[model samples]
Target: MASGQWRALAEQFQLICPSGGAPGVGSPGALPGLASCGHWVNVAGLQGWVQALLDQGIPSFRCPRCPESPWLWQELCKLGLFTDEARARLEAQILVQEGATGSYRQCPRCQRLVQRLEPGPLRTPCLPCSQQARRLYCFCWGCGRDWPDTSPHADPRCPLQAALHDAPKIQAPPSSLHGCPSLRACPRCYALLSHTLQGYPSVICPECHCVFCYRCLGLSGGHRLPCQIADRQLVCGREAVTLLPMGAQ
Candidate 1:
């Protein structure tokens, strides 16, 4: 949550990297350190776990044994668990997943990530591109198209409003998320995420680690139980319904 807390947590565990079977060493995986959750983990094992989570589109890095205690980015970096390049890539994915894609878009010319400095107009300028070209380079932040030399106040061709109103729909069947918008902004951190139907209707934001119900978009208390608002109205124009267990009908 905070830098100080992460630093304190990082101090609680000793991470040992493999030294190629040095003297008095047992095995590469034998260097186990007790994590903050009191579970033993090796550097290699933890790395594998983090990779698996990333592969699954789940960005939250928590103790394998305890999902409640999250491993902050700073803590992971301080522990040498991730390289600089890896950390940058992971943070980029987290930003996109956290619903920052709406605000942060790639420059149309150079394709470098850019965002509005003060949010004046939809025609946002890319400083890196401008510096490289020795001239102003702006783009339509709404549609990701090159900004025309016409009036900056109007772009009738931009389809951002239509795209936003017609967001993708979830196709997973038998789940509460079915028929709902595939993409959702986390209620806490506003991180955008698409449910893969690999788990329940509740999800944990990879950015803020906030658990929320994907159906009614309410805070789920760690998803310990079924969503209480499962039967409420949804944005997809269909009443939300929870599928009971196969034998519970």
Candidate 2:
């Protein structure tokens, strides 16, 4: 292709990848994983195009993939997108029995179709409201229902996972002296949050609701009281005793 033609082709192929994480086609600068398969075809060739992409673990996607056709699932299945492991799980659990209409696999308990099935038997967890809070264990990726995660599992998102990746590892700017006794600086936002009493259990960030333990100065909640963070975990932690009004105390 000519130099001008190459630029035009690049522009034409610069399709944005959805947040669903199909791969970023928004820019040519993106890495191979982020870039499209470079097949560059319309809906007619979507099936073949995606297959070629997934063969290399590169997700293929395009804009306006709506009016979901019935054949979409069948085509995806034919491509072996649903792995064998998933099928094995679905074997014993009946997904949707024959002659059942107006609903997908009825929840064994609630009989609701709000839950979506994916990759054969790798079905999502049950809805929390549909069942009780205590009985439910695993989370359903379909309805997005679950209890506050204590330990780690294949919950898609790490509940134990902190946005520590998003923000600075240790960012504790010293608070100006002579602030309210109830006030403490938020490491995440750098704003001051007010607690009811000195050395309170947790200081709830009014802006972000990001709970931080006043004692240990680590991200915490009512679930984990008295944060045992003896050693300073902040990235570049500095201890600055905040000044409080003497008359108030």
Candidate 3:
């Protein structure tokens, strides 16, 4: 459904949660709740709208009634619209679309989405896991193995450095992102992202709303010229000089 239509409906009617409770409450009967825009929205309808956006290849998720108000993943979780399973499914679909399954990983313990913000040691802490376990819990970001208790900084056995240095290159020859690292972190927020290689080398981070060139890792406004394709290689005004390393950034 179009966003405008959804917005109209949301503004006119009180939204009922399909799960039958106010947001963050465990009540069993349907209860109305306000969206971030202060408009009432049906939880089920809003979920469907988000799905439609993803299906249409639109990555950003914002309130239909208020486009300027973006929905963070955490907020969606609290609204009970995106359970762990549902969120995982949505993430899988995005990864498939971007051809970047390697760019993201799930926390080994809680299966929460996890990504390295900067080139760093293989051992990474999962906040959800730590919260649940009531202690610091870490796992290898590169190999997806549980972090050994013997070390605090680095994984003794994982070949994380080699994995980062030998990261895969974009394989889409017809696109301008070809030959660039398949994995990238948002230049502004350091959120993990991957390019589909179907359009311009630029992308908007769903997390921070930062528009940047995926190929050069530069803000869109900072680019002096558009990225180009030369000899089946991506040529940007500024080229990425290094891949993410295993050491801390």
Candidate 4:
């Protein structure tokens, strides 16, 4: 990326550390090539990181190979820091270390070796951590919101409903569910789950994981529905039932 573009991104994302801080400008022990501006970053495995960033909707960011430490990238790749190669290393290390401490080995994801605190063993990736760092690097473009997740309307500012309003829906093949009817969002509330209300106009949900047609949800409705995980469905002498198509039986 161009130096100007990098500066714009830094300004936009707040990536630069404050002066005199660890990554601050002109620090002697700072990463090579960053001594002058302090924004010099030695992101060795930055290509993969940048790809992940792009998948999350960050535009026009590039990870440049540090001419000096191109070998560092190769070293990280060989060590399998971001791949499953490190899993065996992590497992063996944990087995040796935790046994001495009188603890069983654990992998949080697999739970085979549960004592290792390393990121490779713990299944969850630290995307939220990276997003938090990105915020520190760049200025807020739109109103700040949580990073995107699996929700249909994941983009906080430009929701899926707004983006899909004008798109055409196609009919499905003969072997299909619901004949591929074009979905319509709630005109009032803007949700993907605006199906017709059949049984109860209001269902009292205890765990409150219910998503309903606008008519069946919200504060004025004065109703709550249990999440799928709730042990019991009934609350206050009423029970909430999920309504799916007859074929969904």
Candidate 5:
């Protein structure tokens, strides 16, 4: 990659952190040849790169090769050079590279071994523990703490607990599962009309009120926008459903 392209990608990924000074660091607006060194960065193997920089006395971003020791592994992570385990395998897509966490879970009971398999709620059976205890209960990786009698179950600390059950709730009007509590579709422009019913000849739509005909329920010049019912004479019980819902007489 050319130096400019490397800088561009670094900027895109926010990997380039500008510092005031280092022993041989590049100045702002003046980059060294490191950016375009054409070296492929293995986000997962940044430790190797950090080691190489330290051995070679290169000051790309920070003085990695300084006399004292610095943990460039953490710095590389802070620079966004490493793809997260969840997004590691993301394809060539510009946004997020797809990836998955290796299918494994820790045996909280033993605390010395790892379970190698896709973990599930009350599904991962610790063979040694089950055999030793002579019980059929399995372990759940949810909380990493709670164990169940018959099966695995999600615990309060489980990371997947929120994704499994957390659902967004939209609070609507007291009696209606509909649009805004204070506004309704405009009778003319199809704009939201205030529920308070403004203007004369029925509620005049705030937008293009001239076209509003609440009584006839028509549009501008009675063009009758398709948003509402056309040529309607009576509202039937629907209007009363919204208006006279057994509240104000």
Candidate 6:
């Protein structure tokens, strides 16, 4: 019989099974061992409608094993219907049932031995396999970024990552000097330099070469010239000491 004729026979048998329970057109039903088969078709049919809306045109689909029209199956699979295993099993069952010609037999798809009075178009490809076929990824440690690569499951370590891992680390410039009793500064620029200048153990202004008690200099805080100084000689608080002229003292 044609695939459509086969589906009608199966549907009639399911309705008459008493335990199989009656189902509406496109509705799902539970068979003894293949309880999910009916539900699968129902959902698959619904998904096909959604796909038709997405594709904007109904496309022809065919099952690998059965005579039933694969219109719904084709649309669902094209739109990512059931999972790989589910699709495969559903298709397999339909083929086996129809091919048996009413004799009882185990559905290779459902993997269950049962009596079949009819068969339908049942055959689908693996969705997971299809998805995996299109997958890809990569990691770049040097740039610290991960991205899609042409190869899926490629080597985790790349050339850039290796180089970055092997590169030597560098030290930062020192913020303060060690073993110096007090912090001093440059006499001309007032840049903080040595802690002791001209052998005096107190904060010294980097400019003007004046010395002040650590307290007046705000010892805990970085050394600073008095806020209101003007003249070079007496203008100050602590002054940063610089080498003096021969007679300047």
Tens digits of per-residue lDDT, candidate 5, 66-144, equal 2122322223333334344422221112111111112333456753222232234434566546666898535554334
lDDT for model 3, please: 0.55
* Residue-level lDDT tens digits of model 2 in 72-149: 222233332344454333321323222111123334343332322222322334443324655443433222234334
- Per-model CA lDDT versus the true structure: 0.52, 0.34, 0.55, 0.30, 0.34, 0.33
> How many residue pairs collide in each prediction?
4, 2, 1, 20, 7, 14
Q: Judging by lDDT, tell me the better candidate of 1 and 5.
A: 1
Give the poorly placed runs of model 2, Cα more than 4 Å off.
1-48, 51-75, 78-139, 142-204, 207-249
Question: Candidate 1 vs candidate 2: which has greater lDDT?
Answer: 1
Candidates 3 and 6, the one with greater TM-score: 3
Identify the runs in model 3 with alpha carbons over 4 angstroms from their true place.
1-42, 65-70, 81-88, 99-104, 114-128, 135-151, 155-249
Candidate with maximal TM-score: 3
Clashing residue pairs in candidate 2 (N, C-alpha, C atoms within 3 angstroms): 125-140, 170-235
C-alpha RMSD by candidate, in order: 15.6, 17.7, 12.7, 19.7, 20.2, 30.4
Candidate topping lDDT: 3
Per-model TM values vs. the true structure = 0.34, 0.20, 0.42, 0.17, 0.22, 0.17
Worst 10 residues of 6 by lDDT: 228-237
lDDT of 6: 0.33
Where in model 1 is the C-alpha error above 4 Å?
Answer: 6-96, 116-120, 148-150, 157-249
Could you tell me how far off, in angstroms, the CA of residue 101 lies in candidate 3 after the best superposition?
Answer: 5.8
Residues 1-249 of candidate 1: C-alpha lDDT, one tens digit per residue = 444543334334322223322323534435554455554545544554555555556555565334466654444544435665775676576555533333456667866556332344667677656777788778775566677365563544344332332254666667766766666666665556767787677788999997767766667543343434333222221222233222221
